[model samples]
Target: MATLAEKFGLRKASGVGEAGWGHTLIVALVSLIYFLPVLMIIFTAFKPSAQALSVPPTLSPTSLFGLIPDQFVFTPTLENFGQVFNRVMVSGSAAEPTGFDVFFFNSFFISSVSVLLALVIGTLASYGFSRYPLKGNDTYLFIILTTRMLPAIVVIIPIILMFRTVGLSGSYLGIIMLYTAFNLAFTIWMMKSFFDELSYDVEDAARIDGSSEIKVFMKICLPQVVAGLAATFVFGLILTWNEFLFALLLTGVDTRTVPVAMNQAVSSGGRGTDWTLLASIETLFLIPVFLVTFFLQNHLLRGVTFGTVKR
Candidate 1:
């Protein structure tokens, strides 16, 4: 008994035809629960010290009601954010800039370059595996998947030593390559699934029309899985962005990343953490990630398909 408009999602009603109040309520509750810590970081970034670490903590009780209580009431300040920015921007070594700009740049550069490289290469590898009848390919894929299962701790020492010997430690090229290696396992598998979802007819037609193999791949096939690529790229970017262990172990002054710098702040002199400053940096760190995910969410959820291929 639904209208055409409702069926197409162009129009909605309050009850069964559209998302009901119960569904909306469930989703909201789950989102709030999942994002509660992030909410804390944002609100705490604006709270003063005495208020931030008060006996009960300003944001205590953690319920919606508690968030609106008198203790949560405070004059927000930018002092903490300013302090951290100044700390990052001005505190660089002559040889290895230590400023906020350097850390931000290093993180952005390494993650961006590595993810792009991984997307290009991983998708190609996935395509090859999907289209070709190479023997033992499933076993090969399983091995590749196993690489992702290895604990980072077990491999850290070897990676560190290898980088040190090659003089790649602390270099952009080094981190980018290392990240590409780490990301390949997941990206390859993910791309393979997406490519498999498409029929081989498009590529075959292109090839029959005298298109080269590369052209068939680039022009005929890649376009159909755009949504999958976006999702994979987002996944790869997040892995690289949030990477801490290798970045910390292998990188030095010149190439240290945000996560490393954040840890250094908390570890400095063993004094208790700088709460306000920590919260401020955390909030700023969240912006790029949030925007990327939000923009790509549509593509990620619905994905794309080139209408059904003819038999």
Candidate 2:
């Protein structure tokens, strides 16, 4: 009888061990190369503003001429983070809340609301497409997908004109609607695949047992696709959170998001770009995305593979 490792295909072939080690090393190196920029941003965020832009671009926080006398340690300050939130002192007085607070709130609110709307609408549409046959359904799906394929720039001018005509320009509702529309295509396509993978027996049985269509869909179908919903929510959140072009063109000062704020935060009144503060903003900006992905990582793994295997 074969061992469990062989049965599961987990055992390495006898001649390939050295080659596998080489491949692993190559992958590790490539991953580090891609991660270096993120490491740079994190390092710069903690450094003093002067050292952040220092010549020769040292990654170490300490200098040879430091007070600690060549020790590799330097004090990391929260001043950069404070500056991001407008908490830094101004001429010995405490600073007031600048628009950064508003920017942060706007980003959170818009991204959350838009993703929720997209998920709700897209999930329903996807279920209909998966379970209910319509004439020219594939053609309709292809048409919806074509909207995503078009470059945003190609549509922006017309969308802007339409929004202005409808008095939707610079409004939260307008941006949210736009984001929902953009995300809807992706959500539907992704969720439809998951729904297609489900067995129809359960749904059919529920229907035969006097369950209404709404009750069967709500209580039975939706529960089984939780993984897909989590995955779709994360993707939709990311698409809206990092979007800059639409927000920049469509939103006013009152509704600008963090990506727009990051652009404004880069310059400091003709004193060149404030690299440290920008790094601070980027570091904070990554937290919500990171947290969401971290929490849903297991669901994401299952979601992406949900339909690939057959029992």
Candidate 3:
């Protein structure tokens, strides 16, 4: 009878002409190592506190042989999720709203608004740059890239002062505009590359057919770069989602994002961190990001590689 390994063509080094399996094994091992922390997070978030902090760390062993605790069969509970959702927004007030809900909304609103702004402003700028061929074009692009490359801390003080002058500090509008402005340069550069790769013959033909410029752009050019739009949109979303320094410095209590909230939760009191609660919030926080990546997976690959190769 064929062995278990034999059925799937798993082989030993004894073969005369077969390729070695060592590389495959190494890759698999590295992959497992990389996922170990995530596995621990999943295991910890669902387990009860006792189980989550078990000595020598049970790894969620549920069943026991003689003294062995089996890890696979523990009952799951939604208490941690409930705790996160039910956290008091105002600690010392009569009207105690839920904190996580507000933070979640802020994160969503900021990311979404910033994405839209980047798309509109960046796409237009990219299209203009692609079509206009301005003098010192490379220098202009380099300058734009420099803005994105600079650290948030470098400009935080000046921005705060600027915001204070216009009454924009610690407001949702402030953070939204900040995120949009921060990502705008990268978006323009990326979308410009996509535009540069496109042929202008179709747009020219549309214009010669008496189509308006907007119509030509909407009908002929925009459709060709859907992948770029999706990729750039996703990048914008990620940048806003993960942005910490500016969010921390610029956000008021009402406008705090999930990342800031999570940091506050972990950094609260300074006694120690709540690993269980932290893990739960973090896992839930990542759901939207994961969903975005999953839904946009198809376009991301193609768009990210837009100008890399010629057809």
Candidate 4:
């Protein structure tokens, strides 16, 4: 009987026995290298402000006698996180709130709504293109893609002017609209590819069973492309959440997103950057994206490779 590894065509490293320990060691090393910066951020987030800026950075918490420089024996504290959320005491009084909670809400709302709008509109458009071909369908797709190809900076001036003329500058709606527009081209192209890869047999069978076109799309076709939708939503959310230029230029203090707030938090009051506080903010900022990716990891993996395999 063929072993599992042999059946899967995964051979052990030559001359290294059947365990592939050498290959496993190499993969572990590469993963560690990739995660080193994230580990540093997390470590710094728990350090005191002074320790975070100490000469020759140390990964371990600082001890009174300072254990060996490389030893992980320092004490951990929540001072930085307290400062990030304005929960720290200042001069024996409760510190004023920093409004970080508002920034987080703004980022979440804008990213979620923009990605959903793009997904809905793009999915319908993609289905139309895939199922109902027209004389210039390819040309239309290329045109839509060209919108994404343009440098965002190149069109910022005109967009700013248009938003101002429409009295939409600095409003949540304005930023959300811009994000949706930016995400639309990517959504359309990606979803269209998935739809194109789907066989027509299932859809045709549904049509023959007295299903309306809309019913066929809603009940049959949409379910088949769920992985693709998940992948597109995650990418679009990341892009909009991290967008700095548009948020900086178009949003007011009341509507500012986390990225813009992070920049201000770093240099606010011109008192120099607080490395520990910055790390704390970065750690918090990573949570939502991490959670979303974690929950959707299986779908994301399938979506990315959906069209590559052929039966």
Candidate 5:
């Protein structure tokens, strides 16, 4: 009788092939290690307080020995979600009007507006740079990059002074403008690379066919760079979403972003350190970014590598 191994063409002495079982085992182990923290987070997100905080944490339901009261039976309640949405609980153990809803909306508004402005400004700058060679181009690029390198704290006073002079301080417009300015450097560099890789012949052909320059750009060039746009949108969204210092320093109560609001939630007295609530809010905040990456990851990879190899 042939054994199970024999049925699968595995012999006693097939050792160290590139496609060997050992390689498969190693790959599986590496994947598990990389995913462990995420799995733990998912578990904690679903757990009740005692389960979430249990010392020598139980990795599975069976570890509880089914001894938990039915009241605590991992019953998923939307109470925390309700709290996050319905009311911004105030300081103390008692719930107050924390205004997280306002913060969430502000974060979305700031991120969206900044990304739109960035793409527009970046597209123009990148197109110009791609079409024309400027003197001291390397120096210009470095100077632009340097703008991003300046410490946020170092520029806060100048920014505050500038905003104060213009009556933009602590306003949504102020923070959105600040984010757009800061994000523009990177956006231009990335989009310029994309534009440089594009075929000039296509645009030339369009010109010969009597298509205007603007038409060529709108109808021909833009289609080829859709992936670049998606990649840039993801970058700008993430930068704006996680930007805490500028949002915190530049905006007042009405314009606080999720990150700043989350931080502020912690200093609201005894309830500030509610790890469970914090975890939940963090988990919620992370979902949109995750979905964006998951959906656009293929396009981003392809766009980023578009011109790297010529076959």
Candidate 6:
């Protein structure tokens, strides 16, 4: 009887240990799955052209001794990143010059200008919607949202023609206008929700103190909705920075946006199809977005919810 009891106790301990080990293994596998793409991009970015195109894509391998051995070969080089930054010389218009310096400035200028314009205009539009509440306002809101739902590609040709007629084609103004229109719906809707959460009494109190409408908005409502504005600005900035379709179709040479330039680079297909270079460019592109979010992450979350509650 004593021997049987000991065997039973040992079996139960082994079963519990195995279950715990299995759970840990599952968690480690899930983490690896999430991290694999990031690892691949980083690895690919530094691979030499020949190795980059090599069949079976040697990402990671360990030797028999459980170490990455020197004999376990891989070609590594920074030339791909160099090419992405600036190509020495490539003939033809499609193979035109590409410099991170050029496209970065264009992207920054267009995105900043567009976001500023949208914030100003969209805020005013949202305030009006919240304050007035006139008949057909619901219809108007629907119309605004509907604008964003339209296929941007479908209208690109017409917009290009319109810009040409007005001498705005390929110009900064043309791109800004195109972006602002597309982004307006989201900004207005988001801002309106934030505005709706604020008490009407606060504005009424300001007016009673003889504050002008503009003054009230500037001094009172503006402070209350600063978080919403920040959120909107970030959203708008991301949209404009990453926009490719309109930038590609609308802008020419000097005015081309980063994504457009990147697309042009790949499409031209000389050293253009180089995935290592593509990976480096993508890394550069993503860094700004990552930094902005990382730096202001706390402020953004807090600001977006300032006037959200009814109290």
Per-residue alpha-carbon lDDT of model 5 for 1-311, expressed as tens digits?
A: 76543443444454234487888999999999998877666555556666667665646544266665444345444456555555545435555666888988898899989988999998888888788769977777778788778788887878888888998878998998889988889889988888888888878989999999899988888777878988998988998899888887789889889999988775565653665566667777888878987898756654433343355
36-78: candidate 3 lDDT, tens digit per residue? 9887887677766656665667664355554544554555666
Candidate 3 regions with alpha-carbon error over 4 angstroms = 1-29, 60-75, 87-98, 269-271, 302-311
Compute the lDDT of residue 215 as modeled in candidate 4.
96
- TM-score computed on alpha carbons, candidate 4: 0.86
Inter-residue clash pairs, candidate 4: 61-74
| Whole-model alpha-carbon lDDT for candidate 1 | 0.80
Write one digit per residue (lDDT tens) for candidate 6, span 1-98: 34432433333333434457789999899999998887777777777767776766666533446565544446667777778866755455343346
Which stretches in model 6 have alpha-carbon errors above 4 Å? 1-39, 55-78, 90-97, 207-211, 269-272, 303-311
| lDDT at position 147, candidate 1 | 60
RMSD of 1: 4.9
Q: Model 2 scores what on Cα lDDT?
A: 0.85
Clashes of each: 4, 0, 6, 1, 5, 0
Worst 10 residues of 1 by lDDT: 89-98
For candidate 1, the per-residue lDDT at 69 reads 75
TM-score per candidate = 0.86, 0.84, 0.80, 0.86, 0.79, 0.76
Candidate 4: list runs displaced more than 4 Å. 1-19, 61-73, 87-94, 303-311
Clash-forming residue pairs, model 3:
60-71, 61-70, 61-71, 62-70, 62-71, 63-70
Candidates in order have lDDT scores of 0.80, 0.85, 0.79, 0.85, 0.77, 0.77
Give the TM-score (vs. native) of candidate 6: 0.76
Residue-level lDDT for 128 in candidate 1: 85
